[model samples]
Target: MDMNTTPVLQLTGICKRFAGIVALNNVALSVRAGEVMALIGENGAGKSTLVKTLTGIYRPDEGTIELAGQPVRFANAQDAMQAGVTAVHQETVMFDELTVAENIYVGRQPCRGASGRIDWSKIEAEAEKLFERLEVALPVRARVKDLSVAQRHFVEIARALSQDARVVILDEPTASLSQREIRELYRIIRQLRDAGTAVIFISHKFDEIYEVADRYTVLRDGQFIAEGALADITEQELVALMVGRTVKQAYPKADVTPGEVLLSVENLCHPTEFDNVSFELRRGEILGFYGLVGAGRSEVMQALFGLSTQVRGNVRLDGKPVCVTCAADAIKHGIAYVPEDRQHQGAHLTLPILQNITLPILSKVGFFLRGRRAEENKIARHFAEQLELKAAYLTQNVSELSGGNQQKVVLGKWLATNPKVIILDEPTKGIDIGSKAAVHRFIGELVSKGLSVILVSSELPEVMGLADRIVVMHQGRIEHTFNRGEATPEMIVSAASGNELAEDCA
Candidate 1:
């Protein structure tokens, strides 16, 4: 990385506000050419606001932005792109109906001879070249709707590269990627650095920052806290800077004695997804399900939650057989599920936080909210305070909150249902360390109150730290089950990978 060159992108006194609430206060950042700068912050600490400001989605109320030592401002996204600045966001924004090649070069297609007709062949050829440069195999003619999450991210990166962008902002690029895809993305970031591109990498994972970033910029409560070389700072110091205190542990488990079984699933079978999946959740206990990407853990949970059809299973609550054929049936049986895809399945983003929290309980609180606004506000405020939700007000739209706050809203929605069993699938997947600790503490608090939990996670540390017992699945079948004191990381990973350990290994 070149250190002596002038910064490719620099911001000074960047201040932004929404309805008189400060989102960014005198936030400043600088990124030199050929270097990876890690933008570190907790959710709602103004990282997303800063990214939007840089990408031209939102104009700063007070600030000066300079590119290559020249003052400039972008009126819109197109203007920012034309000025050699681009951002590949976590939530991909692209036309699902368009092919990959078309999505990459949507507006700027090469023109034909003098007639200036659309040149389809050149577009596909250029897209193929870009994929080849990145050493990824993707069908250029395939529609983006059929692509996976990682594939969509690759398409966004290709688009950025195709535009010859000098400054690239990758916001949580690896959040949805598998381990192998994450390694590939790391290589791509290094390639961009080698080619003299200024990369602003934003992620909640510390190991990723330490691996790929050369410098660090920390934000705390909408203000700049620190900026320096990554090599000179320890991970502990960075966490302290971002959250203003020491987070001693990412997973905090509470001690609660397991009671009799509260929920039992026997021979849970989903046609073509999973076979003979069985588990027991006792009151005050957290039963964890760990597996690889396609291990069918989520499929089993979805079927149990009545989201899948043709599911053959016998579920009992407190030793009484119950029938759950759909979402409403499951809710009636005191079962609540927090889905992994929070945006699509968990929270109603267009609704206000108060409305979302009280949605599941509309049967009790009349749908006509004209006379029941006070009741709705009381319920929402109780959960919001319990979750420590950082939002402007109960009437604030869920879409306006950050990722962590959005997840909290979803969680509050389910908790408002007051279910006996809550199934949390990857609850803290994309949130930062501070928010993760808060969630872990909340989980402990839930179990202490005698609510059984079914935690389905791909992260090993989370499962091992919080689960009273773990059920490891491999290829849609139970590979092993380990008691709390018997499981090790190696044993659990091996089981998840379909490798059988010796009898004494655990």
Candidate 2:
């Protein structure tokens, strides 16, 4: 823990492979106490694979891992944690039925007095103490299932902190967080570093790294490419190192004439999650919904797409009244939705990529029970090509692809449905810049073909560049609508935060 001392962790000559895929090839990384060492690479570039090897999700094929100058091999994640290492992954793994406190201290619960029973009150009190230290305001007694994604993540971090970990790895922690939550997480990370914890942060976002990381290590094609102090490189240069090329503008935007209203929602209500929301999506127009997490944006999209059963709304498609009581009804009315959580609601991970794409339109192709293999393959191949999906073959499992490729599967699946209205929720999350651009361009093409798009995104720049018109939401209500020229990052943020436009917020 000395200021001028050795790194807390060092990995040299790390190599890993799965079947024929060489995931990490001699990757080297080091993390120092009181510093945030950012490990960044595109999806499938051995970032998660490397972390898994270190945390015992996979044993490295060849490598030397040292903690505090002594070599060590983690037999499992629990072994790593006991050895003062912990990781919070992109997806949270918490016991939903348990209380937040119980989830935080699942393995190491405090003992009660004479009865020798698990002390539930003590558990809640200890969790509250942890929350106080991390400045995370989560209800300790609340069921983990009731918490938002961001709150669950904070619980994970609090658990790690409670363990007094020497090295903590946070992988894409901000992916589900709002702007306010991101700033809060940054403060907590700074606190962790100041307390002498070596933080190994991983993210695809460049701006966040420069904001919070002290040193950066770039991995390319499963090999270490660069490592140095953050001050030594600019954002553009840092991106070049991480990606091995220049990334131009994020999206391909062109002027598209707005045609007739394709989809109209009036008095839409999902009584359980969100209520009283209304908006219009015009043909050849991208309508963006921007708000903080829990702003009910995704809920509104779900209601429109017929996922929530309690939805009450008047929906008009091409000026004709439509009641979407179920997903089939929505699809029958030419509506498609790509949900926010890809792992849970989007793709059928156990199935093949080809099956996922063609599953929606199988009946339409006149193939119901069996012997539809040829038609299914054709439909999948067409969309795979259109979306630039990279896969060894159509038969590959959907879960085997990287996050970006998995997202492509989701888009291709909905696109195969051939709907007039497409609703996308956080479509580009965890995807690389190239893939993000490709996805955005595909949205442009969809709108160009007279398809209406309702885009829900947390990235302000993305919304600014892609949306022809933006409808800001706050506290489950539409705050204000802005044309592309009228919206700025500041203005949109103000609206999303439920503040009157800053120029008039008084």
Candidate 3:
């Protein structure tokens, strides 16, 4: 971890453009060996594009890339890998059926001397060595699909190390990991740094950045804002650089007194998922569900939305019993759900924004009999405008939009359904502070209009800020419920971590 040595990887005047949109403009970055350089930016801040360029996924329209004091131009990902530059993405790509060792050496397996046959034993031994080096205990013979999320990440890292990667880029590696898993990952990162590997850590969590990074690089709107030692700047200053302005209020929640109960669940149970879950949602109320990753918060929401078939519960809407057997039934009951995985469950990436937004209400738009484009546009435009979606046109593909804009599209689509009870799961996950504030404001406006919202989020600040009532879940049951004024971070966290002081706080 020498500071005086030359950077192992360097980029100068990097510019990347896509279909007339400038994704990265004159961005410069340098990563010295044996250091963890954190790449911090808001969503759509050109971080992904820069990483793509670095990995040869997308060639920069203009730039100079240097590796080990020599100019290098990678033709493709394989070319970059050969040059000792590799990236382990958030959504890991590996053959689920393959063994951990097989996946680690899939295409690059060592051949038996003179025999030209695959060397399986060597591969397993090598994977074992890599795991040992990372101080992680993982079976080399275990199937990839059988591994946990954290173990899968370890396999990805092992694969990168197998390629002898000097510059390893980790893209949002901790997004879905638990606190303990995150700590393990940090230890592995430090190990890599100590071994003289330049680690590029990309994340939105400021606490993680402060804890792990040795240096910081900020990107905003496709340009480099600043770079300095991590110890030289404060969190607020870093946030300001990423968003181009100080966020006056990260949570712009408006005060609203909830009215009569709109929806109530009694003894909701899903065999192996959650058990005996019960809650009430009042009119114009935002009820927040806070829990750890495996606390079964999302499972409860899924069951309530009719996505789980084995769910047993008594749901009363407006004091009347309602049975929702499927998503269609849930929709018919005036309950709309924005799923946690926006990319997979929320919106169709290949479809246009307008089409995605109008998908839920196609029949309402006369699409069953004779679809009217005008009607679809009108409905899509109304919600799109309301959500302030930033898109070039209604016909633009959702895949082309940024993470924040993609989330807005998902919200706009569900809002078009005009549901009385809307369930938003991790609504602002992976979005920037500015987008988060905008979403909070929108939620406030919705509740002001008498719309009841059920918010499920892993983020404590978001739940505390927007929820009028906080419901903490652990394992598979509701452990505690607290009114807005009564909840504290410590209590909520303790409950979420399965250390609830009481059986029921309510």
Candidate 4:
């Protein structure tokens, strides 16, 4: 093994296939000591498969993995870790029932005090020491379920650090974290790097990458397209490489003005989900609800759309009261919702795109046997073109398109209903910048067309840049509301975190 020249980990010509789909072909990456290598690609572009292969979750069909310049084959996750390779994924899984100390030291538990029982006191003390070292607030005895999502994520990171591995892989590490939490995570990562640990950061956030990554590796269509010093590449170039194409404009602004009040809610109260929620959505206005997870943003939207049972509110459409108790009622009132997790809830994977796209408006059609197919195709193609869907035809399976395109299909399905108000929940999750630009553009256009839009997004930039008026929520309560030129990212994020705003202007 070459001490000065050997990479910490070297992957050469990696190739993997899944059900006749060539997921990875001729992909290569080399990770050095004390450097953070960012692995970025579009969804289903083989980033997960590549990491799985490296961690022994999946074996590459062809390629060689060299650790310290010596070829090694990892039989399992444990084996990979033993060889100094550890991965902390997007979903951090641990025993909710286990104590923090036990969760951190799972496989190799600390010795008991000759009683053959787990040394609870020793475990707690050690856990406290680790938390202190990282400057993270965590109770060793606290139940995992009692902690917040961000806290649980930190616990997962603690477990990874406990492994004493030379290389760490983080997938979407900051997805659910607040800006403050993200800074803390970055601090810990830098601490790890300073300890000579090589970090592999995988995230869709461009700013986070530029701030932390030492090098950038871009993968597209399961193949390594570009790798360069992070400082050498511009953000635009990086985006282009990940998408493998040129992206035009984002925020496709359409010329629009308020036609009328499309939907108005007067003194809405769902005691369980929300209380005294009052708002009005005018035509061609995008009112974005900005809040941290569990701030009751989604719940309020759901209540208005008839998804919540305990909702008591006056929902009016065009100066007339409307009843909403279920999805059918919402549809009847010309309200469409593109939910979060489009794959899980919005699309039928086994069914073709046409079926999913038409499911919302299925009952409206007379089903003339002669022109049914042509009519369906025309409708699907029209919106698909508007969305710039990646698939070739309307009959293609929704499961085949990228994450961005799948989301577009979900929007298309709802758009088929000719809704007066559209509610989009985390509409751009797991999507690339190119696709994100497309979606922002589409939303701008839809709002311009006198379609009221209630957008729930975790991305601060999305909400701050696109929303006409921003409503900030904190702990199931409306903390503040900001009109145009007032709602900045700093204020929204601060308010969402339950902190007092510097300038309290509701």
Candidate 5:
């Protein structure tokens, strides 16, 4: 990979404004061929907007994009793809019913000479060649819906290569991949770089950025902060640039002793999702659930929250047996769940912050309010302050907030219910380092106030740092449980991958 060559893609003085809110202001980025540039930023740091601008999804209010030493303006995503610039997003947008080969050449398939009919054999051959180049194997005739997440990503990459793309953008590609799959993706990225493809890698994990990226570009609050060789800076320094300040402790675990058991589950079974899942959440304790992508961590939590059907379990709250058959039942039993997919399940994006916060408690507060607007405001304001929520006003919609602030609103909404037990599934999955710190502190505060927490996270470090007890799940069953100070990343990951360790059984 050559660093001295002329950049294959460059952006200068890029600015994008939405409804008078500046998303990107004079941001600049340069990506030379045969190099991987890490785009580092927190949630709402203009990374998504910049990606949209680069891909022609959103035209910048002011900027110039240069590809191969020539100015280029993309009228739409198709235009950008034709210009040899393509992006593989985190959640792949592919036709589920289409075959892998068909998806690769869906828009522009090779036609038979003279006849001008679609050449299916040529399409499959070309798709095969693309996967061969990437050193990955897949059945070209397999339907996309039958493929795994990693396979879907490979298909997207194959599509990029099919278009003869010189600049490829990968946005959080490894967020859902397993350890082995991630390693494979890393190898493919290096392959693209060695082939002189300029790659822009976007991720929230610093370790991944440092491991795969040759150079670093930092964006904060819609502006470029710095750009340099990754070797010249430390992770702490990079984090400081992204958040505009140093995060001394990413996980500030408070000292809280576990009290008597607050909630206990015995033989919780979700039939297909999970089975025989049993755990106890003590008052003032954070019980962590660690697992790989399909380890049934979230499934178990959903069942506990009464969001799953045909779930058979004996649940006891505060020493008394309880039955929770629905979400309302869970809420009535003092259980609140903040789901992982905040956008779809956890938050009502179209609703105002005030309404979203007080939604669950509307019955308790009188649904109509009856001129109790001040009381509604009072409730919303109290939790907002507690969560340190960042919003212009309570009337503002949740859709207007950043990922971190939106998660805060969800937290505030559930906290408003005053539940004795809260289930936070992947609470800080996509937020930045600063927002993660804030959330970790809040979790600590929750425990200190005698609130029991069930933290379902795929991040090993987070679970180990914040959990009093870590439960490892694999293949829809509990593999092992580790008390705090006794669990290591190796042990947790090993158990998560279904390779239970003998030494950690205790």
Candidate 6:
């Protein structure tokens, strides 16, 4: 690829505002043909707004957009697609009842003749060709709902290519994918670049940015900060640019002494999810669950939290047997769960921050009685301060907050329950690095105050840095266990990938 070639897409002085908030302020970016440009920033740093503007979901309040040296203005998303710009979002939106081939050629299906009858055979053949070009094996006749998350993403890409897209934007594409799926997606991205399509890869994971992107662009607080080659920049430097300061310790794990067992699971089994998962979480301990995608880590946690009815296990709390059949039962037994899907399961996006925080404790707030607003506000304020949540007011809807702040609200709600044991499944999954550090510090504080926690994460560094003891899961079973001093990235990766379990570690 010629570095001096004209950019396939370019945006200069892009500015967008929503009422009082400035989303993108004079942001600029350019992507050359056959080159991968990484668009990176912290949450609320205007990455999403910029992407929406580029894709014509939001007309920029101010900016000049050019494609191949020609200025263009898109009226809407369809217009952008017609102009050869398309996006594949993180959460794929498709008709679940439609077949894969239909989804690939949904709005612009081929017509047979003057009668305008749909050409099903042509659509299927084109879908197959697209998959073959990307080196993906997927059946065109399969229903969209029946496909895996990775497969759905591939279908989205195929749809984009079928629309004659010259510039392809992928927003957080690997967030839900497994290690293998991520590698395959990377391969497909490289193929697109080789075919001379301008690729914009947006992600928070620095490793992925370094692995797949040829050049990098940084955005901060709705402003373009820098642009440079990936090889010329360091990870620390990139973090500094995104956060406006250096993050010395990404994992702020504190030293705490473990106490007597608080909760114990004995031969816990779920018919199709996980089997014979036994572990003991001690007071003042952060027990980490490490696994790849589909390793049953989240499933076992959900079962322990009484979210699964097919679970068969004996749970003991504080040396006494306990039965938790539902979420209410789990809360009653002093257990709280922060689910992985924060947007759906963790926090109520439509509710105010105060209401979300005080949701689980409504019973104590005198639900039947009036005039409890002060109490609710006080409790919400306390936890919000503890988590360092940034918001204009407690009355602000959670949907208005950034991803990190919303996650904090989720943690706040569970903390307000006053449980002895808390389960956090991918707590820092989508939030930025600064928020991750804050959450890690908060976890350390919780354990220091005699609380026990089950930390389930796919990131190896997170588990290795914060966990006093790490448990590796594979195929719904516990494969290995390691103390903080004994575990290494290599051992955890080996166990997570289905290598032979180490008897000694177990």
Candidate 5 Cα errors over 4 Å, as ranges: 113-116, 350-355, 362-385, 390-401, 494-506
| lDDT ranking from best candidate downward | 1, 6, 5, 3, 2, 4
TM-score, every prediction: 0.98, 0.90, 0.96, 0.83, 0.92, 0.96
Candidate 3 — worst ten consecutive residues by lDDT sum? Answer: 497-506
Per-residue lDDT of candidate 1, residues 40-135 (tens digit)? 999999999999999989999999999999999999989999999999988899999999999999999999999899899999999999999888
State the displacement of the C-alpha of residue 42, model 2, in Å, after optimal TM-score superposition.
1.7
Q: List the residue pairs that clash in candidate 1.
A: none
Candidates by TM-score, descending order: 1, 3, 6, 5, 2, 4
Strongest candidate by lDDT? 1
lDDT of 1: 0.93
Residue-level lDDT of model 3, residues 1-506, one tens digit each, is 56778899999999998778889999999999999999988877888889889998999889899998899999999999999999988778899999999999998899999999999999999999999988899999999999988899999999999989999999989877888999999999999999989999998888888888999999998999999999999989998898888988877677788999999999999889999999999999999999888889898999888898888879999999999989999889899999988998999999999899989888787765655778878888887888777777899999988788899999999988899999999999877677787788999999999999999998999899899999988899898898887866888888887884544442
Any idea how many clashes model 4 has? Answer: 1
Query: Model 3, residue 251: what's the lDDT?
Result: 75
- Candidate 4: list runs displaced more than 4 Å: 1-4, 107-129, 245-248, 272-274, 291-295, 340-406, 416-418, 448-450, 458-460, 471-506
Error of 3 at 386 (Å): 3.2
Q: Candidate 5: worst 10 consecutive residues by lDDT?
A: 497-506
Please give the range of 10 consecutive residues that has the lowest summed lDDT in model 6: 497-506
The sequence of per-residue lDDT tens digits that candidate 6 reaches over residues 1-506 is 68888999999999998877788999999999899999988887888888889988999989899999999999999999999899998889999999999998888899999989999999999999999988999999999999998999999999989988899999989989988899999999999999999999988898999999999999998899999999999999999999999999878787888999999999999899899999999999999999877889999988888889888989999999999989999999999999999998999999999999999999998786777899999999999999999877899899878788899999999999999999999999878898898899999999989999999998889999899999999999998889987866877888887886454444
Looking at candidate 4, what is the lDDT of residue 347? 92
lDDT of model 6 at position 393: 85
Q: In model 4, what lDDT does residue 497 have?
A: 84
lDDT of 4 at 159: 76
- Please give the CA lDDT of all the candidate structures: 0.93, 0.86, 0.90, 0.82, 0.90, 0.92
Off by over 4 Å in 1: 502-504
The candidate maximizing TM-score is 1
